[model samples]
Every structure is written in C-alpha cells, then in structure tokens.
Target: MPRHVAIIMDGNGRWAKQRHLPRAMGHRRGVEAVREIVRAAGDMGLEALTLYAFSSENWKRPAQEVGDLMGLLKHFIVADIDEFVENGVRLKVIGRYRELAPDIVALIDDAVARTSENSRTTLAVALNYGAQDELVRATSAIAARVAEGSLAPADIDTDAFADALDTADMPPLDLLIRTSGEQRLSNFLLWQCAYAELWFTDTLWPDFSRAHFAQALAEYAARERRFGGR
Candidate 1:
C-alpha cells in the first residue's frame, strides 16, 4: 500500500448547484465525507493522509461563504476531535493556519495537542494553504539563515529545502487524488507530490466513499513508479 495519500476535495459547490441546495449544505455533506475517508484510511493502515482543506486564495470568495467555511471547520474540529483521539489519528495542520480566527486557532491548537501522541495514522489538514506561498515562506526562512551566517549557500539541496516545508515530518507522499473530475493539482502540495502518482475521479467531495479510495489504491498498486529511472 502507498504509505501516504493526499486529496483535493473539490466539487462541493457544483454538487450543491446540481441538487438545488445551498452551498453550505454541500460543505456540510463534504465534512461527513471527510469523516468517512479518515476512518477508512486508518482502517486500511495508511501511514498518512493529507487533505487540502482551505487555500490562501480562497479568501477572494464572498465574505459570507468564507465565514461559512470557517464555521464548518470549527464544527468539524469540535465534533470529530474525540473520534480522532479514540482512533489514534494524529492531527497536523499545514500552511498559515494560525492566521485564521483566534478562537478557531485555539481550537486547532488544542485538538493538535490532544492528539499529538497518536501513532495509528496522521491526518494532515492544509488550512489557508497555497503551494507557492509555502515555497516562498520556506525560501525566505532559508535565506534568513544564510544571511545570518548560520548556513552556507552551497549547502542548499532538495533535502535541505524539503526539511523546511510544513510536511517535512510526514511520510513522503506516494499518491495524490483529486475528486470531482478535476485533473489539476490546484496548487495543493506541489512540492511534496513531486513524484507521487496522480488519480482523478468524477465523484464529488460529498459523494466520495471508501470504495472510491480503494479503487485509487488498487490502481496505484498495479502501476510501476519509475521515479526518473528506467
């Protein structure tokens, strides 16, 4: 089995439009899907699962929608944190998550602290995340170290750069799945997924199930990863 898998949960808005329901309703259902998938990943013995929860660019959306998304996130953490601890799932948040609302940040910090020792699986959620922004931040930090004479320019390498990323402690990404038939990465985990196999499905976020996840894994098992070697 692939040691790590990440997902771009898309199509909640489209799903809601298709069903003649409010977008908030779709997001609510999407949260349910998140719960199912996390449970499934743990049961299947995956080492890590990273979810693209919210992107930095998402701030351009309407104020009310953004507020709704924040509310949903707060609810998810409050409602599911117990289950996470019970199932041995460690909670890790990436990107500028601390820039979120103060109360939300506190809740996230509490949840992360509460589940820090779990070993069964790691669930990394990318909140206020953007690959380009992450890269810039990482680069800026490394440059600062160089300026301070604490690091040499010649010492920079892929490993050194990766160590500065938010996912530095997580397992190397092995498979990336994008739902809702989207075939693009959407600026999610660009650095971490450099060599990961890509999978896309027509299933929307709210409709994604364990079966779909299993199918992706089965396909991953059948393929050969060259990793730039013949």
Candidate 2:
C-alpha cells in the first residue's frame, strides 16, 4: 500500500449545478465523500492522507460560497471528532491557520488535540494552503537562519528543505489523485509530489465513492515507480 496519498477534491459546485441544487448543497454532499475517503484510507492502512480541502486562491470565490465552505469545515470537524478519535485517526490541518476565523481555528486545534494520540492514520486537510505559498514560507525561514549565521547556505539540501514543510511529520507521498476530470495540480503539494503517481478521474467530489478510490490504488499497484532508475 502507498505510504501516503493526496487528493484534489473538485467539482462540488458543478455537481450541484447538474442536479439543479445550490452550490452549498454540493459542498455539503462533498463532506460525505470526505468521510468515506478518510475511512477507506485508514482501512487500507495508509500512513497519511492529505486532502486539498481549500487553496489560498479559493479566496477569490464569491463571499457567500466561501462562507458556506467555512461552515461545512466547522461542521465536519465538530460532528466527526468523536468518531475520528475512536477510530484512531489523527486530524491535522495544514496552511495559514492563523488567517482563519478564531472560532474555526479553535475547532481545528480541538480536533488535532483530541486525536493526537491516534496512530492508525493521519488525515491532513490542506485548508488555505497553496504549494507556492508553502515554498515561499519555507524559503523565508531558511533565509532567516542563513542571515543569522546559524546555518550555511551550502548546507541546505532536499531533505533539509523538506524538513521545513508543513508535511514534515507525514510520510512521503506516493500517490496523488484528482477528481472531476481536472488534469492539473492546481497549486497543491508541488514539492512533496515530485515522484508521486498521478491519477485523474471525471468523478465529482460528491459522487466519488470507495470503489473509485480502490480503483486508484489498484492502478497505483500496477505501475513501475523506478524513481529515475531503470
């Protein structure tokens, strides 16, 4: 099994539109998909599952839609905390967490704290996260250390830089799947996914099921990941 897997959950609004429902309804349904995928990942024995929950660029979306998304996030954490703790799933949110509303940040902290001891699987939600932004942040920290004469520029290497990433504690990423037929990274884990196998599907987030997830894993198992070696 892949040590770590990441997903770009797309097409929530489009799924809602196709059903003649409001965008918020699609987001609400997408939450159910999140729950299913989390359980499936844990059951499959994945060490970590990183989901592209919200990107920094998502701020450009309509205010009402953004508000609705935040509401769904809060509800997901609050309603699922007990189950997550019981199932040995560790909840973690990565990104500019301080940029979030105080209440939302508090809830995120609570969820993380509540399940910190669980070791079955780590579920990382990338909220307000962007790969470019993450790289910039890491670079800034490295530069600060260099300027302080605490670190030499020549000492920096791939592993050293990776240690500064938000996912430093997580396992190396092995598979990355994007739903809704979107064939792009959309500013997700650019650094971490350097060698991950990519899988894309037209299935929208709300319609994404355990079967679809299983298919991705099966396909991953068939590939030859040489990591640049023959």
Best by lDDT: 1
Residue pairs clashing, model 2 = none
TM-score list, all predictions: 0.98, 0.98
Q: Write the per-residue lDDT of candidate 2 for residues 150-175, one digit (tens) a residue.
A: 88999999988998899999999999
Residue pairs that clash (backbone atoms under 3 angstroms), model 1:
none
For model 1, where is the 10-residue window of minimal lDDT?
185-194
Global lDDT of each model? Answer: 0.96, 0.95
lDDT of 1 at 162: 95
For model 1, the stretches where C-alpha displacement exceeds 4 angstroms are none
The alpha-carbon deviation from the true structure for residue 46 of candidate 1, after best TM-score superposition, in angstroms, is: 0.7
Residues 82-182, candidate 1: write the lDDT tens digits.
99999999999999999999999999999999999999999999999999999999999899989999889999999989989999999999999999998
